[model samples]
Target: MRLLVTGANGQLGHAIDAALEAKDAPAAYVDCVVDWVDLPDLDISSASAVDAWFVAHEPYDVVVNCAAFTNVDGCEADFAAAFSANALGPMNLARACATGDAALVHVSTDYVFPGTEPGERLETDVPAPISAYGRSKLAGEGLALAANHRTHVVRTAWLYGEGKNFVRTMLRIGEGRDEVTVVDDQLGNPTSAADLAHEILRIALTDDYGVWHCTNEGICSWADLAEAAYEIAGVNCRVRRCSSADWKRMNPQSADRPAFSALKNGHLESTIGNQMRPWREALEDYLR
Candidate 1:
């Protein structure tokens, strides 16, 4: 199979490459041809560029898009740029894939849901995004699904691996600090990018085309995640749990986040059997 991975330098992209190279990687990838591209190599937001690239690299069996405008606060600052990258980018890829007869697997986030409802969200649940980043992602999901029948929109949460992320930030901050403050009101799963990448590959192999939630099992607040990371990494740091409002008070320009945006892998569980491990277990593995 000929595979194309966009945003090739990001955390999930790196993890996908690692997954394909792992000793126990799936047999399906043994004979796969993969192409990694990002930024200057390809601007997915441009429709003409995407079409030309598809024509040049014809017969792509599958295209996995990890590219996204992930800066939440920045999205609020520049919604147009965010929409262009997060929404228009997927639309362009989906259009090209529709014409080329290639399967499109687009990575999304749990922020698409309004966190006011306190429960694990299912794929069937309606998405009412409250923030700019969330709105852009939600739009991307709809656009991709509408533009291509063979599209899989996988939603994940609190991801970390092979790049700058919350866990890495905590580790860096805790190195010289006795205590660090984190938001306790916000709740979601802390997913390992490696685990998510493995599942993405599994999802791409099947014909299950629709919305899917794939995150490490279990949920926790940001403070809880920081404390867990400290404990696992043997860091001497105390977690001062505070509400989201407190966080906003400190960082006035920060974007609003969901209070409870944990996602349930309902589709994955029913279809291919959810393989994502618990958040703490995944975090331990990631840290180690």
Candidate 2:
């Protein structure tokens, strides 16, 4: 199987690369040949460009779309660009995959839910996105699934890796500040991109395809995650937990987010029988 990975420079992409490398398995062993692609080399938003690249390259058995416009606040200001990247891009890939008779695996977010309730969300839960970013991703998920019968949608949350993410930001800010305040009301699982990448590869190898929620096995608030990061980094900064409203007042430009968007990986666990590590353990590995 020849696999195509989009957004090769991003966090999850890097993790995928690392995971593949660590496997150290040849195409014969895994029956796979991986091809990485990203912006400048290929613009997923442009349908023509996406088609042309697929035509020029070798036929891929699986296409995992990791590219997306993730800026929550920016999506509000530039809805068209956000929709083009988050929604249309996946549609284009889905069309290409359909034409080539290839399977598609789309990386989605927990933002797809309104997230007002206080419990783990199942794969069967209906989506009612509250923000522009969430709506765009939901559109992408719908298009991708409808465009191809062999499509797998994986919804994840609070992702971090070797890139600019919440953990990295907190560590950076802690370096200069003696005390940092984070929102305690917003709760979700903090996932490791590396772990998610590995799971994506496993899904791609399988014939079964559908929507699944994959994240670290536990949940926490922003303040709790921040405090954990500082603790792991051996930083001496004091962490102050604040309500969502207080956080908004402090950072007026902050974007609206779900209060409780944690997801349950019941489908994935049942299908693969591979348990995801706890969020705290993943965080420790990432920090180290």
Candidate 3:
């Protein structure tokens, strides 16, 4: 199979590469020819560029889109860039794949939902994005699904691996600090990129084409995640839990986040049997 992975240098993209390289990679990936591209290599946001690339390298069996404008605050400041990357990028890929047999696996975030409702969000839940970033992603999701029938929209939350992320920030702060303040109101699953990559591969192998919530099994607040990271890494740091309002007060320019955006892997559970571990277990494995 010929596979295309965009945003090849990002955390989730790197994790997918690692998974394919691992000894335990699925048999389907054993004979797969993978193409990794990012920024200079290929701008997925450009429809002409995407079409040209697809024409140059025809017959891609799978296209995993990990590219996204993930800066939440930056999205609020510049919605155009966010829409171009997050929404238009996926649409371009979907349109390209529409002419072929490639199944598009678009990675999205739980932020698509308004966190005001306190519960684990199901794939069937109606999305009401609050911030520009969320709105862009939601648009991407819709466009991808509409453009291609073989599209899998996988929504995840609080992912961290092989890049600048919350866990890394906590670890860096803990190296010298005795305490760190974290928001306790915002709740979501802290997913490991490795785990998410594994699941994405599994989902790609099947014909289950629709929205799928693929997050770690458990949920927690930002403060809880920070504490867990410090504990797992054996760092001597105390977590000073604060409300979301407190965090917003300190960082006024920050985009508004969902209060409870935990996603339930209902589709995965029903279709392929959810293999995701608990959030803490995944975090421990990642830290190790």
The reply for model 3, stretches above 4 Å from the true place, is none
Residue-by-residue lDDT tens digits, candidate 1, 77-175? 999999999999999999999998999999999999999997899999999998999999999999999999999999999999999899999999999
Return the clash pairs for model 2, or none: none
* Lowest summed lDDT window (length 10), candidate 1: 22-31
Query: Residue 117 CA error for candidate 2 (Å)?
Result: 1.1
Q: Roughly what TM-score does model 1 have, to 2 decimal places?
A: 0.99
- Comparison by TM-score, 1 against 2, better one: 1
Give lDDT for model 1.
0.95
TM-score of 3: 0.98
TM-score of each: 0.99, 0.96, 0.98
lDDT tens digits, residues 68-119, model 2?
8888989988889989999999999999999999999999999999989879
Q: Judging by TM-score, tell me the better candidate of 2 and 3.
A: 3
lDDT of 3 at 74: 99
Q: Cα RMSD (Å) per model?
A: 0.8, 1.6, 0.8
